[model samples]
Target: MIISVRVQQILLLLTLLVIGISREIIQLELWALPLALLSGLVLQGIGDSKRRRKWNIASVTISCLSLCLLLRTQNPYVLFYAIFFTVLSKFLIVYKGQHFFNPTNFGIVVCLTVFPNLSWVSPGQWGNYFFPSLALSVIGVLVARNAQRLLTAFSFLSFYSLMLLTRYLYLGDPLSIFTHQLKSFSLVIFCFFMITDPRTTPRSFKGQILYTFLIALTGYLLQFHFYIREGLFYALFFICLLNPLINKLFPAKEYQWAKKI
Candidate 1:
């Protein structure tokens, strides 16, 4: 039996959530996950009803899981806002029938910018665990491969890693510095899930490669030069603005998800 890519994604995220919660790594309230998931589903249902379309539970759930995993906040209202805008963006922000911004990325960035005091993303929340990182990479690769967005994920990781290595070498730091950075599970999630979102990424292979490069360069600058911890999220958010131009320049067949078996 074959599992749909979206189903695979949901399972993978659920596993990560369980691992994080079990290990006491994810610092979230007991009610936060349910609230995010429920809010996302209900908002998506409302959008579908308004548009006279079917509810996309998979996509909405994925976005909500992303929020629950990455975002940390003391206030429930902030979480609601993040999920609200996350789902709202999918309906309001469209370009030629496609949403350029990754929904979860948009939500995270928005909250970080708008409610910096109340909301934050802990990049180190997952810690530098070897086994979990390896598992994430292996499973993420499979999911990206099935979704046909492996190129986007691989290119982003490669480019981002190169940037880290270059910066470390410039500073005369040991190679371990670079290797340690690669252990960030948050970065892995961003690469495999957020950046590789098929509906949001460039349609053409060339466009996707170029897009990843830009994200890497911008993220590096933001993290190193500007001293921003949440640089990658902002990097993706801003670079997504150029996606329409990227698609226009490197026109190719638009990606369509495989029908559920």
Candidate 2:
């Protein structure tokens, strides 16, 4: 039986939440999750009302969960602002009837940039455990497949992995060093959840492939050359600026959640 893409995303993220909490992998406050949900839902409701559209609870929940999972902050106000801007960006940042910035990504980058002392991202929270990484990959593939953006996810992973491998080869590093980098759960989640976001990604398959390739290349340069830890997020933000042009060049039918799979 096929499931809604949003539903699959929620389930996968919830599973990660449980694992992260139970294993004490993530350093999140107990109140963070509820605050994220409440703020996102309330803000999303207001946005929907303004547009005369029904509220999308699933989408809001997914964004809240993503924020809670990736973003870390001790201040409640910082957390609230993150969720506030995350939901607000959906309504404010639009181009050709679609929002290009992934809401969660936007919020994280905004908070990190604006509140550098209070906010940060912990990419190593998920660790490099083989079994957990595999589980995340399997479920992430299912979610991406349901969203009809599996190719986007895989292409990003492939391109990013190739860059890592090339760098290791150029440095005369061991193959294990390259494989060790590939074991990151944060990278997997970025590939499947953030970059493969249907609304933000290009409609055409070719466009998506090209889009992800650029993201991979930009992220590699930022991480390796500039030494930015959150290079993927920055790369996606920069690449999204060119999304409209990519869509124009490789136009296709826009995706709708209500469309039959």
Candidate 2 segments whose C-alpha is farther than 4 A from its true place: 258-261
Error of 2 at 201 (Å): 0.1
Quantify all predictions' global Cα lDDT against the true fold: 0.88, 0.88
> Model 2, 1-261: lDDT tens per residue?
977878888998888888888988777898898899998999999999999999999999999999998999999999999999898789999997688888999999999999999999989877776676788788787566544577788889899999998899899998887877999888888888888888898888889988999999999999999999999999998898899999999999998767543
Candidate 2 Cα RMSD after full superposition onto the native fold (Å): 1.4
Measured against the true structure, the TM-scores of the candidates, in listed sequence, are 0.96, 0.96
Root-mean-square deviation (CA) per prediction: 1.7, 1.4
Q: Summing lDDT over every window of 10 consecutive residues in candidate 2, give the lowest-scoring window.
A: 141-150
Return the clash pairs for model 2, or none.
Answer: none
